[model samples]
Target: MGQKSLVSTWHYLVALAAFLLSYFAGLPMPWIIVGVIAVGLLRYAILSKTSKIDAIPGPLVIVLAYVGFMAGFNHFHQSYSMAAIGLITTAYFTFLPNFALIFVGAPLIERTQKNTCIQFILSLVTASVVGVIVNLACYLGIGILFPSGVSSWYAIEPMALVWVLFSLFLLFKYKIGMLKLILLSLAYGFLLFLWRLNKMPMG
Candidate 1:
């Protein structure tokens, strides 16, 4: 099998592991979904005509970032087990999709002569939107099943904001289509309004 096929197969296994672990441990389904999505995107990129999957840097950077963030969070919040788990899970799953983007889809995308930069920016925006929607659904489902009394909106609002900021950065850097940018911006603004209304002061 080709390197792309090998990588795609490995990603599938990793996603399966994530799903099983999350399901049995009741850790969180969103992370598993993210893992699956990452693997799926990686496979798609590898099989696509453009062959952009070769452009992304290795997973080293993302791994390092995850480790560093986890270290810092643990250092600051050692006593908070739930908070630590949430942070670690979020950080780990956040970069799984990037693995596909950078390793499988990015290189080919970068080399394209037809507005590659714009395409990259648009892809980020699209990914952010998808991530937000999926995560929101996951959070709501978890709340319904557990009834742990956690606020679903509060749980997801921060991550959604982070994705919005990321999308905004891409939009600004690459000068994506005006209409899409405006829509993303408006969506972000609406999310922010909701967050502010629900936010309790961190005393």
Candidate 2:
């Protein structure tokens, strides 16, 4: 395989491994350490081989940095524990799929198309919609089942909104077809319902 393809494959593998680790470990020490190491390796390998750093959007970088800083600030005031470190480490896993989809998968989709730019935009929007649906389902199910315990729905809302709006913007910018527009609208409606049910704001 070519260098790019190799790098993409490695990224997918790393994402899958981190996801599995997070799923089984439930924000514990070993899993957190594994996730951090996996992310570090993925970033380093991509940078070294492709000379392409993950071009995270400026807004996302700022938000993540702020979150990290705040978390660190909290740690400074309070005693930092393994549990806190693990939670923060696990939270980083959330971005892997988003980054992999847009950077690794979307480029391949673009390359395979005659109208690469248009296809890339469409693929990205579709993936974002799917991601939103999956996350919504996850959070809603947890809320319903637990009813009173700690829930992830509120925590993930901002990131989900960002992806949804970004996807919508891409759709408008690319002038996606009416069929896709309708489908995306329905997906958004479902998302709204879930948000309301979970007592989370749409944006």
Candidate 3:
């Protein structure tokens, strides 16, 4: 219908404007949400007679994928020596919104499921983000336990290797939560600490 297409166009325009504003701003990205509210109160709610700003989360997911990819690339490619806790923090900021939306904004997406293009984009973003999280987790875990750097074939020790396997298992089997990921990372760090203490030539 003409009316449905018009509504979709409006959503895209608002999403694009907010996305660009946030990217160019010096402050954090959530300031984009504030800008959307201001515009909604003035132009959308009054001048344009648009009753509400329907947030099309497709754009948000796209941003998350980019941030996750950049974070993973930077953390790994820098000699792969970043702290596990540091990388976990980055994952939090990247995934938190998607986590929240799984309950709140998900229903809205289902309700307005007419746009096949949006649905296709959303599916790709979801799959890409999952891959990013898994890959980043593996790198951070390995880097934490192997500060000297891993081989091209990755000849990690047995105990540290188990932690790596467990991380992947949690990711694939149990829908790994944020707390579990952080705790597992800490466990890896602690185990590495014990290994160093044992390697001090036994006094």
In candidate 1, what are the lDDT values of residues 1-203, reduced to their tens digit? 56456435534544443443321222223333344234353343322211221211224334323333333334335435533553465456445654554566557656674886777876775676567546645544453333334566555445545655677687789878857765775687678678887886776
Better of 1 and 3 by TM-score: 3
Question: Would you estimate the TM-scores of all the predictions?
Answer: 0.22, 0.23, 0.35
Worst 10 residues of 2 by lDDT: 49-58
Off by over 4 Å in 3: 1-113, 141-146, 152-154, 166-188, 201-203
Report model 1's TM-score to 2 decimal places: 0.22
Residue 67, model 2: lDDT of 30
Q: In order, how many clashes per candidate?
A: 5, 0, 0
lDDT of 3 by residue, 23-71 (tens): 2222223332333333232332211111112221224544333333333
In candidate 2, stretches whose alpha carbon ends up further than 4 angstroms from where it belongs are: 1-59, 78-125, 136-147, 150-203
Q: Report every candidate's CA lDDT.
A: 0.46, 0.44, 0.46
Clash pairs, candidate 2, are none
Best by TM-score: 3
What TM-score does model 2 achieve against the real structure?
Answer: 0.23
**Candidate 3, lDDT over the whole model:** 0.46
